[model samples]
Target: MNKKGESKLTIVITVFAILIILVLSFLFYYYAVKSMSFSRSETASLSGYADNAGRKESAGLRTNVIIFKPSEVLPQQQKEGYCFSTSVADPFRQDAFRCQVENEIFDPCFTTEEQGIVFCQINPLAPEAFLIKLEKPLPKASLLEFTQDNWAWFVKLEDKTYCSPFTGTRPFFSQDQIAYYGCKSNNIEEQIVLIGDLMIDDIWTANKAVLIKEKDNWAIKFLEQIKIDSVWQ
Candidate 1:
C-alpha cells in the first residue's frame, strides 16, 4: 500500500476505536444507574407491601374499631373542655374534665410531646380517650379531649382498646394510620397490638406493641421495632 493510504487507514481505525470505547462506557454507566434505581424502587415496594399486609391481617382480627387522630389546632367551641362522643344527636357531650395549666388533669396522666403537640393520657381507666393539649391553648380551653370512636383508626377488643398516635414514621405514617391489632387463641405468639414511636438504642424507632391473648383477653408483652437497612441486602 502507499504511505498516504496507510496513514489514512490508521486514522480511520483510531477514530473507530475511540467511538467504540465511548459507546461501551456510556452503556456501562447507563446500566449501572438503571440497576441502582431498580434496587431502590424494589426496596420501597417491599416496604409498602409488607405494611399493607400487616394492615390487612390486623383488620381481619379487630373488633369495635374506633379510629382517632387528634387535630393540631382545636375549633373555637372545642377549646372549652371538648368532649368526644360518637352519638350523632349529641356529638360534644360536656362530661369530660378540662385541661388546666401545670399539667394537672388527674394523677399520673401520661403526657408526652411529639413534634410540638402535647398528648396527655388522662384516663388510665379509659385508654381510648386521650387529652390533646394544644401548643397554643385558647384562653377558655387549653385541652381538647378525644375518644377512640371520634377519629379514624383504633381497634377495641372487648373492654380494652389498642392503637397509637401519628408520629410521621413507619407503621404510624400518615398514610397507614391503622394501629396493628391481632388476636390469637394461643397467647404464646406475639401479636401486633399497637403501632407507636419509641426510643430504642438511643434512636427513635417506630415500634409495635406485641401483645398476648389469653382466654379472650389481650395484654401487652413487648415492643417490636424493625429497621430495614436494605431490602436487597
Candidate 2:
C-alpha cells in the first residue's frame, strides 16, 4: 500500500481504539454504581424484615429478645488523631469487638467546632441492631414526665409514646430532641454499621448506616442513601 493509504489506516485504528476504551470505562463505572445501590437497599430491607418477624409474647412485649449494646464515645480531650479506634462490649453475650472511625466516616456528621463522640449500643446477639448517641447537650429547659399503660417515663422532646416496642417501655431523649431505639430479630454476618453523616452536604444529617464487607474492604453504596437522616428537624 502507498504511504498515504497506510497513514490513513493507522489513524482509523487509533480512533477505534480510543472509542473502545471510552465505552469500557463508562460501563465499568455504571455497573459499579448499580452494584453499590443494590447492596444498600438490601441492607435496609433486611433491617425491616427482622422487625416484622418478631413474635409478641405479652402485651407490648415479645418473645424475641433484642438486647441493647451500650457504647460510649471518648471525650474530645482523648481524641488522638483525625481517626479514633474503640472497642465495645456486648452486655448480654459478653463478647467484645473493635470498630475504627477515620476521616471518611467522621467528617460528614460532625463539625470542627462540635466535639464528635459516639456512644454505640451494639447488641451481642444481633450487632446490627444498635443505638448511637452523637450529640452535645444544649441548655434548653426542664424535664417533663408522662405515664402510659401504668408505665411512667420522662419525656425530653415531645410528649409522645411508642418509640419502639423493643426499645424498652419508655422512650427517653438522647441529646436535645434526639430519640433512638433498637430491635434485633436476626443476626447479620459480615456487616459494618455506620452511624452519622452518610453524605458530604452542608446540611448536618445523621443516619444508621449498614454496609456489607466485600473481601478485605467494605462495599459502601456510594450512590444510594445509606440510612435516612434520623435527625429530627
Candidates' C-alpha lDDT: 0.40, 0.33
For model 1, how does the per-residue alpha-carbon lDDT over 61-142 read when each residue is reduced to its tens digit? 4222222333354322212132222222112322222244443332112223342223333322254444444544322222
The C-alpha stretches of model 2 lying farther than 4 A from their native spots are 52-233
On TM-score, the leading prediction is: 1
Q: In lDDT terms, how accurate is model 2? A: 0.33
Candidate 1 shows a clash count of: 8
Name the lDDT of candidate 1: 0.40
**How well is each residue in 1-233 modelled by candidate 2, as lDDT tens digits?**
99999999999999999999999999999999999999999988997777666533223331222223232432333232232221111111212222233332221112223244333222122233222233333222222243122111111111121112122232232233222323221346423222322232322222332344566544433222232212211
Per-model TM against the reference? 0.27, 0.25
> In model 2, which residue pairs have backbone atoms overlapping below 3 Å?
69-121, 69-122, 71-120
